[model samples]
Target: MRKYFHIDLNDRSIETQTLSGEALARAGRHFIAKTLLENDVATVDPLSPDNPLIFSAGPFAGSNFSNGNRLSVGCKSPLTGGIKEANTGGTFGFALGQLELSGLTLYGASDEWVVIRITKEHEITFESAEPYMGLGNFEASRLLHEKYGDKISLALCGPVGEYLGLTSGIAFTDPEQRPVRLAARGGVGAVMGAKKVKAIVVDRHKMPPFTDRKKLMGSIKQYGKLLREQPVIENFGKLGTAMVGDYTNTIGGMPVRNFSSGQIQDPKDGPLQVGGQFIAELNAGRGGETTHACMPGCMIKCSNVYVDEQGEEICSPLEYETIGLMGTNCGLTHPDQIARVNHIANDLGVDSIEVGAMIGVLMEAGVGDFGDEGFIKDVLTEMHKGSEKGRLYAQGTERVGKHFGVKRIPVIKKQALSAYDPRVIEVTGVTMMLTAQGADHTAGNMHSIVCDDKTTEEVTELSMGAQKNSAAADSLGLCVFGRSVTEANSELIVEAINAAYGCELDPSFVLETGLETLKMEHEFNLQAGFVTEDDQLPDFFYNEALAPSHKTARHSAQAVNEVRSAHF
Candidate 1:
């Protein structure tokens, strides 16, 4: 059994709930949504003490259950004004599982900034965060390690988060002890900051107990074997997620210059400099890692360590979203330029997607020229300092666009859209437009869906199914990158869960968890005053056609909502 803690930061009180069997399994996004909905978190001010910040680990957490240690951090999003479940792969979840803890919720705000430490001895201490305050994640992480030693995983609120920046995301320590892995969207960091939690330091220990260790071990080996045999997984392991840019660029679905045009470079002109194939080759030649695991036991290792010409580390896991939004969207052609900014963004613990979109909008407003790396650096520096201009930039893309009176802001539900442009990537666009999580591509990323001739109903149907699947993956702490294997082998997946927890669950439980998660999240958003009209792409997407394909979003909010309403 694992213990879930209700931490009252107000009075330093703690309430523990023991979870076993399916209760331990039914965690992550599903748990967050259900708890929030039940607590009437919808009406609470996102930054208020009433808004609980939840962290959940999956059933197989701390085990060698490839990609099963991803942590879900949730709250009413200060950025989107709706429910948010921002999950990330890191050692945080693994640490929680090691300590035999399923999850914890920070209830109410602390009077001062503090570091909460959880030890293997079952001790919870609230330490002063004074020294770590006003520091970036890198420095804070170092100091935390210095104070608490290296045998701990961290969840840090960066300098931006300390000031309650909407662009901020809670940074988690990776297996390598780098606090770069982030639950990086929808202002979860801002909520953590508002709670005055500078960091959560959990001591790492050996893997926790399981009901059927032999069966679970067999399942683990089987899952790894299945992963090794999959072609898609192999490709990801080789080139990482940047390979997605190659396909998106080829199809004219890649976001370029603040969503002005889709295609970045002609395929006839050799490989696109910004595309995955090019980056993989470039990094490989520079003696940098093209494939690395962000979390322990993740054999599908799609993450990377990007390097400069001198083979110096620039950034770890330079991803497609960061490249598309921060590189192509901002009109910066070189990966080096993107990498420098990525490091700074990661250091500041902000969502590179939101910050990139915000910067792109600023460029669109003529505040700075496109491709001007110096100007981008200046803006980020200000953000780190929490200057007036920096704080304004941190409000995120939507508000920043309004502040500058820019007409073509790329946002849905006040959250910046992911790299996928709705005009060309229709199914992903539908998912982004409708998801309660607010334009998070992970909610249901069907980048391969063909919508060229499909009706709005047909498109929504496809989107709905993908959403359920994605939600299930998130709920289980399984990476969507493993879906090619996991989705096809649902019986095996259920068998593994049953083996670990000694509970009986069918394959259908996967989709059921997803469907239930969506329903709960949607209900929360609805009661939070979000109307059907809130689920839509910006006006520019509907009116302006993306180049090459010259396509515009055709899915109407009304039609999509009609189908969703019927199902939900």
Candidate 2:
């Protein structure tokens, strides 16, 4: 049986060690659920003040499975007044797994700023974070590398987080000590800032491997072979996530001009429709670099290092969401500009999606003309300088709308919607609104729903299923990409788990676990003061008809109400 040590940062204290077994399973569920509820209640209570954030990993985290490296960072989102779990890839999972720590629950605000370091040699130390304030991720990373060396992985927040910017993100160092990976959603960085934690560095030196090595390795080999044989996985390994840009544009699902249209004629979509345009453009001139992996021993290298005109490395892996939000939505077709923006966001420790959405909203409000790269760059410069306008942009879309006195803002629950338009891809929009995390595409990302007809009922059904599936994937510490193969026979995932853990379990139990987690989060939000009104999209989406496609938001208030009713 696996043992877990629950660390409560509420009083900078530790709880008694807990063991995970059949006897404690129900107790574990209740304990976690109660912890979550207490945090939610405290967030609203006048007497007891606390801001809680939970970091959790499943038992399968350190296993050899291809997608088992996921880590979840959950908190009440600064952007959205509900539960938010920003999942990401990093060595933290393997490190935590090696430490046999299932979850780290942090609560209460610190009087003085601090940084926590967990070394692989079973050493935990807390240090002052005063000197690290106002440092960008690149500079902070350099400082940590100089002190901790390349073997240790660090998760750090930058000046944006220090300033309590709602869109700020946490940056985690890769194995190379580059601040490349991110827990870059739902403004968890702001929550960390509020807690006065500048960084969490994990050092897993000389830690032994997982317990069930033989069974884990066998399952990993089987899944790795299955992934290698799949054509989609192979293409992902080759082209990386940016390969979806062209397909999204071609299918009229790409968000263009603040999602007013989906049809965009941007060269960023791999040039004009010449045959093999994607391949040809990739081959021409140092643009399309070789795909690479984010972590050690990752077989599907679905990431790339993008370069600019001067052969300078611009960014690591220009993705579809960045392209859609920064490229087409902002009316800028230059991949170099997009890459630069991504780099800027990374350095500033802000969410690229929110920044791009803010820029798009600004353009829509006529503050800057669409496609005006110079103005866009100027706004970004202001953000870098921490000016008033920069602060406004950093606060995000709904706040921007309030500041500018504009009601036509594209947001849900004060969070900006992502790159997919609701009209063309209705299911994702529904999920964006209904998810505990507001306006986050990744909260559900109902791409599978695009296969079905976009009727109101079908859209609702697909959104619900996608939400459940996403919850399951996240809880299992598996990448959603693996869902392409595993989603159909989800039972196979349970079988793999059973084989690795030497436990007999039915697959339905996995789904049940996910559903329970989702329900817990939702209940927490309800107690935190979220309402049915929060579960609806911004008013503009329904009233305004997006151009080119000529499709208005089809779901009515009643329809949206019905969807939320079903879920609740």
Candidate 3:
């Protein structure tokens, strides 16, 4: 029995509800989809008061399950103009679960900014947060922590969210309590800003009792052993997601120079500056860690902490997407420089991917030379100042591209693509083209898609499978990377679930929940005026041939729609 919390901004009130019976199956993502549809907000403007921001923690949270602390942030996206669910791994999600909370639905809008605090004793407090205005995510978190003390978890935004940047995301602290992890993508933080809520702090002083302590302990140890033995997971523990940069560049999937080329093609150095091993060595020399966990009890710690020349922390856990879009795609060669931009973007509460895409488009337009550190710093300063031009940057790459008259902008539904170049790793491109959430790689992956004889048909099929699995993982609050160990064996997760509530749930129910979530979101998008035509990459992807590989992306609108229709 999980509690449902609904908070009204205008009325400054909080309410709690509970559901059981048939609705129990529809928890987390499923429940969120149902609530959005019931509100009939399919066609409502995402930034309006009527559009609610829903946050849900899945069944695995608060349990001894490994990698089960992902926080799913759900709402009609201002960026995609469709239902959006982006997640982040952190203690907040687990804390919510420990507090026995299933979901939090926020509605209405406030005239002044405020902070919402929830205590372990279930006491709620609202404070005027105007004094903390213009603060960055890190600063805001520190001040909140000072006020509320330890044993509390927080979800907050920075100046980017305060200004309603469409690319901003809600930032949260990791297990060490650093505010670096984020529910990053699809303009989620903009929705938070619209509600005029600066932060939501949850006290984690108490936790619910487990159903079976012995089974939980066994599941935790067994899953930890399984993760440690997997070679991929082991490597992840050594190098984090940035390790994929070198592999993606070799595979012709790295986005370089605004997607003009995959690799930098320098015969002298051979893309070493953007390589993963190079970065791992650089950080190691600086006493920065390449392997760290975003959530507590995560067996596979595929995260990092970057340090500057003084060996002070520059950023924590910079990912391949950040390196690909901001580094190679923008003609940057130094890992330190990329880390600086990542720090700036995160501190300012802007999505690094979105800012990176904007920088790439600007580089393509000759606004600044590629690999110019000063130019990068200047652009970041402008964004922070919110100048007339910086205001354009805040909107997103599509707006900036249209303003600059750049014809080859890589965007879908007004949202920019991630680091993956569509010309290679074809299935991921298909996933971006077809998913209701526009151009999101995390929504699906390219795994299990490539075949001996590659074809557009195979890409579509592989993307569909990955999307379904990913949807399932996100809904269950499980990390998709956990698929490595849990793919062949789901009983571990089932055991954890059974231990949580003493329920005898089937192992397959997790995936089933994810499948239903996808269907609900798909229907919501259709009702929100999305059509088969909207499911597509840019026209340039189909025609433009990428360098080195010299391959062009090819997929039919009919084929993609068929995949979406049949599966979703």
Largest TM-score belongs to which candidate? 1
TM-score of each: 0.99, 0.90, 0.96
Q: How accurate locally, in lDDT, is each candidate?
A: 0.92, 0.69, 0.80
Ranking by TM-score: 1, 3, 2
Residue-pair clashes per prediction, in order, are 0, 1, 1
Estimate the Cα RMSD of every predicted model relative to the unseen true structure: 0.8, 3.4, 1.9
Candidate 3 residue-wise lDDT, 401-437, digit = tens: 8889898788877788988887787788888888778
Q: Which of the predicted structures, 2 or 3, would earn the higher lDDT when compared with the native? A: 3
lDDT of 1 by residue, 1-568 (tens): 8899899999999998999999988899999999999899999999999999999999888899988888899999999999999989989999999999999999999999999999987689999999999998999999999988999999999999999999999999988899999999999999999999999999999989899999999999999999999999999988899999999998899888899998889888999888889999999999999999999889999999999999999999798999999899999898899999999999999999999999999999999988998989999999999999999999999999999999999999999999888887888889998899999999999897778889888888889988998899889988989988888888888999999999999889998999999999999999999998999788899899889998988988888999888779
Q: Which candidate should be chosen as best, given lDDT against the real structure?
A: 1
lDDT minimum window of 10 residues, candidate 2 = 22-31
Q: Tens digit of lDDT per residue, candidate 2, span 1-568?
A: 4444445455667553554532222222223444667654425531122556666665565555776666777666778766677877767765666566565666677677788887755466778987777777888878877877776767787777776788887887654566867777778888788877888877654433443567767777877877788897887877677666666676667777888777676445455331123422543467555576665556777767777656568777577787788777888776766777778777887787887888888988889988777777787777767788887788887888777776667788777788888877788888887777778877578653563455777787777777777777787777777767657656667666666555567878666665676677778778778877777777777777766556667775467658656765
- Give model 1's TM-score versus the native structure: 0.99
> What's the lDDT of the predicted structure labeled candidate 3?
0.80
